[model samples]
Every structure is written in C-alpha cells, then in structure tokens.
Target: MEKKKLITDDGIRYDGRKLDELRPIKFQIGTLKNADGSAYVEWGRTKILVGVFGPRESHPKHLALADRCYIRARYHMAPFSVEERKSPAPSRREIELSKVMREALEPAIFAEFFPRTTIDIFAEVLQADGSTRCAAISAASLALTDAGVPMRDLVSSMAVAKVEGKLVLDVIDQEDKQGDSDMPMAIMPSKNVITLIQMDGLLTHEEFIQSVELAKKGCMEVYAKQKEALEEHFKKTMDREEV
Candidate 1:
C-alpha cells in the first residue's frame, strides 16, 4: 500500500499544524496521592504519567554513591498504549530510553545534596504517539520538582524532524514513521544548556543545526507550560488550605 504524504503542498501537516508548530500540550501535577510526587502530561496524542520517589536508600549497597544520589529512571509503555498491544515486558527500546531519560535529567538535579541515596523516577506511557520519550522526560522533571528534590533547573524536551524536505517541530507518529529524520532533545531551559540529543534517520549538517535550534524553541514553549502547571497546582492547594 502506498503511504500517504505527511505534509500537504500548502505546508500543512497531517494534523493541520504548520511546519515549526507544536500540537496542543497539557500537564497536571500531584495526580497520585501515594507517590511522593507525580505528574501527568498530554502532548498531542501522547499521554504519560510519572511518579518520583526518594533521596532515600539505594538497594544492593554497592550502587550507593559516595558523593551524590543516584538517579534511576524507568520508561514503560502500557500494553494498550499503542494501536497494537505491546508486550508488558521491558523491551530494549524502553531500557535505552530509560537510560537516556536519567542522563538527561542528571544535569539539573543537585544529587550531591542527598549523598548515599537515590532518586527513583517511574514513567508510564498511557497513550503512545511520537515523542513519548521527550514527553516522559518533561513530565518526570516536573514530578521531581513537585517531590521537593533540589535542582539547578527544570528540563524540557521536544522532538524536531524533517518532513517532506522541510524542518518541522513536534512531529507526530505518522511523520516519525514517514519523515526523513527525527531528532529528540532535552535541555535546561534556564541555563540554555542541552543535555540530550539523539537522532534517527539522516540529516545534513545544516539541517542538524537547524533542527536543534527549532527543538530549543519548542522546548521553551514546553517549559512555559510546565511552569504554568506547577503554579496552577500550587495555587489550588493554597486555596484549599485556606478554606
């Protein structure tokens, strides 16, 4: 079967977003009472829930850090998250994404403040679309902050890709499957420091640079939403306390 084109000749994407435009995003913090901190995020069709625990003891003794806390992240997709039900077991892709998420977030955390401990991050994908890893990282960062973990800054992430020979921001699943390139990035927006950059498919040097710049812009927008979600949650809590 012939695949449908991802972008129209008039420059509209499959979902009607323009090149460089992002799909609608929404976030909620402290959604799980049992968790030390938790957040839920919806980025386009992707939905992720994250829970943060610790600054507590690390298991197996040997994994304990002498100078800093260990950050352990796990990324899992629910069986029904995709069009086809995926196996519940952890896949290689999930393991790699978990490692990438931990590394991306490590730069922002002040792990030294909690030596001999570990900060555990659990991210579960409730719905699957393109950019699930980036969305999970963004949500996990907010969960960490809500848990009262010290941090240098919040991390925000976004994916940029080349579709129909044009650079685009926040590609969806169809675009990811059919597009020429995909680049996912995470950054400390306050410091303008990039912490993660992973690419799939191909891009020229110029296109690579352009995609990074575009991804940064998208991350800033995501950062704004992250701040708004946290602030909104706090405001509601304060209102409830006063009543």
Candidate 2:
C-alpha cells in the first residue's frame, strides 16, 4: 500500500494545520471521584485519563525510599483504544512509556517533601491518535497537581516531526509512523527545564535544534490550557462549597 502525503504543496498538513500548528487541546480536572486526583485530556483525536494516587505509605514495605517519595507511573492503553484491539497485558512499549512518564514528571516533583511515601500516576489511553505518550504525560502532570502534589512546575509535552523533509509540530499518527524523525519532548515551562526528550528516528543537528524550539512552543500552549483547566475547576469547586 502507498503512504498518503503528509504535507501538501501549500504547507498545510493533512489535518489542515500549518507546519508549526498544534491540534486542538482540551483538558478537564477532577474527573475521577475515587482517585486522589484525576484529569482527562483530549488532543486532536487522542484521549487520555490520568489518576494520581497518594503521598501515602509505600506498599510491599520495601519499595519505600529513605528520603523521598517513590514515584510509580503506569501508561496503559485500553484494548479497544485503537482501530485494532491491543493485548490486555502490558506490552514492551507500554512498560517503556510508563518508565518514561515517571521520569518526566519526577524532575518537577519535590519528592522529598513526602519522604518514604509513594506517589503513583496512572495514565489510561482511552483513544490513541498520534503522540499518545506526550498526551498522557501532559494529563498526568495535571492529575498530579490535582492530587495536591508539590511540584516546581507543570510538565507539558508535545511531539515534533520531520515529515516530507520539513519539520512540523504536533505530529499526527501517520506523520509519526512514516516521518524521517519523530521526537517527543516534555518541559517544566515555568523553570524552562527540559524533563524529557526522546527521538525515534534520525535528525540532523540543525533539525534537532529547530524541532526543540517547535516542541517548546507547543508545550507552552499546552501549559496554558492546563492552567485554565485547573483554575476553572477550582473556581467551580469553591462555588459549590459556598452554596
């Protein structure tokens, strides 16, 4: 089968976005009543739900750290999340992404504040589009904040890809699968600290720098959306209590 063209002659992506444009992003906080905190995010066609549990005692006893909270993250996809059903059991990609998600959020968290405890972040992909890990990271960050975890700043993420010999931001599934380079990145926007950067394909030195800048721009926008969601949720919560 032939691959569809990702970019058009007029510099528009197949999804009708400019090279540096991002997909429409939507976020909601406090989506789960049972969890300590939760958030849901919809980025383009991707959907994710994240639940953050505990600065509580570590289970199994031995997993507890001496000076800081152990951060555990699980990134999972529903069997029906994709067009084709995925295995219910954890896949190697899911395990790797779980580790990656934990690392990305750890840098922003003040784990020592809740010493010997555990903070577990669970990200569930309800639907997979492109850049599912990036979406999950963004939602997990919001979920952590929703759980009242102390953090230096929120982690926002996005992917940049070299498609058809040109760089584009917020790649879709096709672009990611067929592009020359696909880089997913996360940053603590307030600190301007990069928390995660991973590439699946090749890029020249110049392209890497350009992609970083593009990804930064995308993350900043995502950060704004996150802040808006948090503020709105809190405002509504306060209003309900006043009643």
Candidate 3:
C-alpha cells in the first residue's frame, strides 16, 4: 500500500503543525481519590490515567529487595481506546512497555528511603493516538509525586520522528504509522539526565543526535505543564483547607 504524504513541501504536517510543533497537551493531578496519588494527561488526542500505590510491603516475599524499594509499572490500553476494539488480554507490547516505564522512572525515585517495599504504578490508556508510552511515563511521574514519594526530580518524556525526510517533534498516529522513524525518550528535566531512550526505524548519526535534541525540547515543554498541574492541584487543596 502507498503511504500518504506526511509532510507537505511547505513543511506542514497532516494536522497543519510545523515540523517542530507539538499538539495541545493538558494534565491534571490527583484525579483518582482511591489511589494514593493519580494523574490524568491529554497529549494531542492521546489520553492516559496513572494511579500510584504502595511503598508498602512487597508481596510474594521474593520480589522484595533488602536494600531499596522496587518499582512496578503496568501499562494497559482500554478495549475501546483505539479505533478498532482491542482484546482484553494483555499483549506483548504492553508487557514490554510496562518494563520500560518502570525503568524510566526508577532512577528519579528515592527508593532507598522506603527499603524492602514496593511502589506500584498503573497506567491506563483511555485514548491512544500515538506517543502513549511517553504520555504514560509523564503522568506516572506526577502521580508518584502526588503520592508523596521522594524523588530527585520529575521525569519528562516525548517522542520525535522522521517523516518524509524531515525530523519532527511529537508525531501523531498517522505520522507514527507512516513516518520513517520514531524515537521516544525520558529524562530528568531538572538534572538534564536521560533515563530511557528507544527507537524504531532508521536514522543517520547526525539525525540521531538532532532527534535527541528535539526530543529534549519537547520534554521540557511537557515538564512545564506538569509543574503547572501540580501547582494548581495544591492551590485548590489549600483553598479548601482555608474554607
């Protein structure tokens, strides 16, 4: 099948965004009451909810670490999240994504503070357009903060892609499906340290470097929004207390 042109000659994407432009993004903290901490994120058309629990005893005995807390992340997509109905069973992709998500956020967490315990993070894709994994990690970081987990810094993430021979930031579903390459990265924005980087497709050495730089810029933008959401949540709580 022939792929549709993802980038126009004038440097416009199918959605009319510039090569470096990102779609609209919004975030909400403390969206779930039952979980210790929770957050909701909407990035472009992708929607995700993350719930953080534990820092309690690790179950099954063997999973507990003697020196530091363990972080477990579960990534799931709702049956209705995509255009086609997805099966309820967990797919291999979800399993791998869960592992990477845990690893991405583990570095920023002060797990030694709660040794021999576990911190469980649950990420559900309420909607999927593209970059769901990146959105999940971003939301999960905030949820951990909402749960009052100690951390060195917040983790921010974004995806950059090559479409029609041009590198772009934050590709949507169509771009991901038809683009030449996709690279997602997670970093500690305050510390300027990368925790996770994954890529699919191909790129030259220079293009790889450029893509990482672009991804960093996109993640910084997301970090700002995350800070804003947390601040808004706290402000509302303080107002309620005063009342």
Give one clash count per candidate, in the order shown: 0, 0, 0
Tens digits of per-residue lDDT for model 2, 164-240: 99999998888988899899999999999999999978899999999999999999999999999988889964655
lDDT, candidates in the order shown? 0.94, 0.94, 0.94
Residue 136: error of model 3 in Å? Answer: 0.3
Candidate 2 — which residues are off by over 4 angstroms? 238-243
Model 2: per-residue Cα lDDT at residue 190: 91
> Mind giving the per-residue lDDT tens digits that candidate 1 earns over 1-243?
589988889999999999988999999999989889999999999999999998889997789999999899999999999999999999999999999999999999999999999899999999999999999999999999999999999999999998889999997999899898899999999999999999999999999989999999999999999999988989964654553
Q: Deviation in angstroms for 177 in model 1? A: 0.7
Superposed by TM-score, candidate 3 places the C-alpha of residue 123 at a distance from the truth, in angstroms, of: 0.3
Candidate 3 ranges beyond 4 A from true positions: 239-243
lDDT of 1: 0.94
- Tens-digit lDDT string for candidate 3 (93-203): 999999999999999999999888999999999999999999999999999999999999999999999998999999899999998899999999999999999999999
User: How many residue-pair clashes does candidate 1 contain?
Assistant: 0
C-alpha RMSD of each candidate structure in angstroms: 2.3, 2.3, 2.3
RMSD of 1: 2.3
